[model samples]
Target: MLFRVDVAAAEPLADQIAAQVRGGILRGDLAPGERLPAARELADVLDVNLHTVLRAYAKLRDEELIELRRGRGAVIRADADAARLRLVELARQFVGEARRQGLADAEMLAIVREAQP
Candidate 1:
């Protein structure tokens, strides 16, 4: 899988890396049992610290989207569901936008209700 990061962006490098991996999974570009590039290798390519890549991998692990195995590196989980992951990604974006707009919980819920057919 290919990954990119913007050092100048407000988002942390690790978060950026994680997002890219997540996108790849959601797009079917990265399939189950596929091994990701080693953290050291990816860090060298991205010009970031090794720990940064590790942090990203850890985040993916926490989300159960990837599995980190000794001597095998990181691999996409066999049970990772693209559709469910996509919904989670969309919900996160929606909530972030709502927070930025200063909308209250009730207002957000109302909007979601209206959005439902």
Candidate 2:
């Protein structure tokens, strides 16, 4: 009943929230047809405004990652494709940020290799 997420990139908070929920669906952390918390509850859990959470949910609905049902909150879709796209985008962003931070190719590669898969 708890949801926590880190804010990252230049993406809006709503988009960040949507991306995380999309990823969770793809990774099976949030199973298909599972019930999502109410926007208010999620907002409280994430310490974001209700409007922010609703925006995320709306975005997810548009992406087909979740569907709004009467009195049932949002439900996960059977499949969500947004995850792969988000991962790729995030990787590119990370690479760009690392380069901007003056991390050399060797250093980046070392860090990647050292990271646990």
Candidate 3:
């Protein structure tokens, strides 16, 4: 998967890396069982610290979007598709509920923003 980092962005490098990988999986650019680049290699490519890449990998693994195994590297989880589909379904339901409640898109999004940590 192609990864890029905005060095000048406000977001942390690790978070940026994790977000890109997550986006790739959700958008079908990265397939289930596809192995990601080794942390060191990705860190080199992105010109970031090795630990930053590893931290990003850990976040993905913790979210169950990917799996990390000894001698196996990091691979996208087989169930990621199901998880992504469920999230999409949930979002659709949320939008429907918001519409039924007469909430405008901006208002609904504002509520979401307020609820976010």
Which structure among the candidates has the greatest lDDT? 1
Query: Which RMSD does model 3 reach against the true structure?
Result: 7.6
Q: Tell me, by TM-score, which candidate is best.
A: 1
State the lDDT of candidate 3 residue by residue for 1-117, as single tens digits.
678899999889998998888778867889999999989889887889999999999988988889999989999999887466558657867997999899998999998899888
Would you estimate the TM-scores of all the predictions?
A: 0.91, 0.62, 0.71
**Candidate 2 Cα outliers beyond 4 Å, as residue runs:** 7-9, 79-117
Measured with C-alpha atoms, the lDDT of residue 47 in candidate 3 is 89
Task: Pick out the ten consecutive residues of candidate 3 with the lowest summed lDDT.
Answer: 81-90
Question: What value of lDDT does candidate 3 attain over all alpha carbons?
Answer: 0.86
Residue range 38-59, candidate 1, lDDT tens digits: 9999999899999999999999
Better of 1 and 2 by lDDT: 1
Q: How many backbone clashes does candidate 2 have?
A: 0
Q: At residue 49, what lDDT does model 1 achieve?
A: 98
Better of 1 and 3 by lDDT: 1
